[model samples]
Target: MGSGRRNLKNAAVALLSPIPSIIFYLSLLNHCQRISSTASDGDHSLSLSPLWAWCYYHPLLLANVLFFVNVNVLFWVISHIQSSHWMIDLYWTVIPVMLVHYYATHPLAQYNWWRSKIAISLTWVWGVRLSHNYFRREKWQWGAREDWRFTDMRLQYGKHWWWVSFFAVYVSQQVFLIGVCLPLYVIHSVDEPLNIWDFVAIIACLCGIVVAFSADTQLHDFVSRNQKLKELGKPFVANLDEGLWRYSRHPNYFGEQLWWWGLVIFAWNLGQGWTFIGSFINTMCLAYVTKLVEEWMLKQDYRAEAYRLYQKTTSVWIPWFKSSIGGKDKKA
Candidate 1:
């Protein structure tokens, strides 16, 4: 009975976690609408307020402000309550979808309607796939576990994790989430007609989604098989070097990068090439993350030698044919 009740509570928490954020966004949207109406009616009282004016005129800035309050502040408190920071990981699949719609619904939003729809629809597809993967990895249990990286950091920081996490987990996410979604802002800010680049972007984004889905599926299946083997007292597989893993050490990361870079094409085609900065920064961060992940895998006794060989032959990313080099460890 206790376990069942706890499961129910967790399910509710997962379902309702976004309600406060949605409410805050809607409230802000309504306020922006009011400001727009009042300003048009020559009521300078509200428009004269710089904060309101910025919210009305700058949707990108408004999103950042909302992130500060909703994620940085609200999520931070919730993490303390739950004694976990995994909620941010879940929201990573959510916030882009919200930000895209926020840009579309804002009164100041101006763009080709068809283009906006395309971008918004793609964002939804990406978010849904990612959310599905997150839930699957969690065994459909919300907040069951925090990320291993966060667990490591907690151990590393000891008592200081409480405050260190405020900056490390939440603030860093503010930068990453907002940065990656900059293309959404670009898509909504321009009024350009669809062109060849739009079609190119569509292809690239779809390809990314497919590749990521395949890689993650393969990885999940591999892990599940290993678990079963362990349970049966059989020797579990030490490494995965088949399917997408054969071509790239991290095909999933490559696919995710492809998706973001693909989105950048849309903005670039619309003459907002600077929007690439977001995707570029994301890629750099991913590189560092990839290093950390590799280091972790190498630390595992069973995986160390096999992964070293895999690393020697497979590309770090960008899915290419395996190298001709043998599995012998390179001398320092």
Candidate 2:
């Protein structure tokens, strides 16, 4: 009887491994957003109910339910999970980051820069569309089941031990999101701009947003077409080899990395000095998160011999480059 049940520890490890940091960070942001709403209620006094109750009740129960439900809803409408791309989350975080970064660089509180307006505008446009698209893709309902990872966790944690698992998932993610958002506070407080670097930063931020949008749209088209091909038994092919995929194995990822760093660059250019360092940290975190995702997915395809060949011939994290042996790179 015991042998028939999967180990809770093993399930937790599997559920929590690979991209825990990323999900935690996302949940953290969601929690912070909730906290911010509370602050807007004009209650300066600290509240213990939700924070205390929910903080310890994360990751295991709350986080998975929220995240999994979110994903399923997105996939249901968009035909794919929209925000499943970790890049989308990373890039979305930039909206707050830009506000914080801009405010930090400009402390005089008089400069009215149009770039901030544009950045913030594009940020929301991209974010809302992406979020809505994701919501449409997933199939979510009351009493709905969970993804395999969470199911695995339930087996190991024991049927009676669900609350603990829920706490782990929820609380951990809440903390992670809040930490990453610290940069927003710094960026939002600024009100001055100096040096030519500020303009350059603005250009970079705008360009990054545009590139990211293009990359995501292109990928969406590619994936949709590929699915049709699969239905027709046309053999799995890297359709990305035609458009933006020709230049980079992950153009969307590249654009997303740029989107975050672009905001960071803008903040530094505004003369916040050390605050600009957050860009590097943010970039590293995103890279690590995406790397984990790649590893997880790559290992799942047991019959992916052709996919393996593509991975070998193409760049994994970076843009593919033309080797002396001849293959497409970012410049293709």
The regions of model 2 sitting more than 4 angstroms off are: 1-119, 132-184, 276-278, 300-303, 318-320, 324-332
**How would you encode candidate 2's per-residue C-alpha lDDT over 150-216 as one tens digit per residue?**
4445577775534544344433333344333333343444555455765665666566666666766
**Per-residue lDDT of 221-302 in model 1, one digit per residue for the tens?**
9999999999999998898888998889999999999999999999999999998988888899999999999999999998
Q: Tell me the number of clashing residue pairs for each predicted model.
A: 0, 50
- Estimate the lDDT of model 2: 0.47
Ten-residue region with minimum lDDT total, candidate 2: 79-88
Best model per TM-score = 1
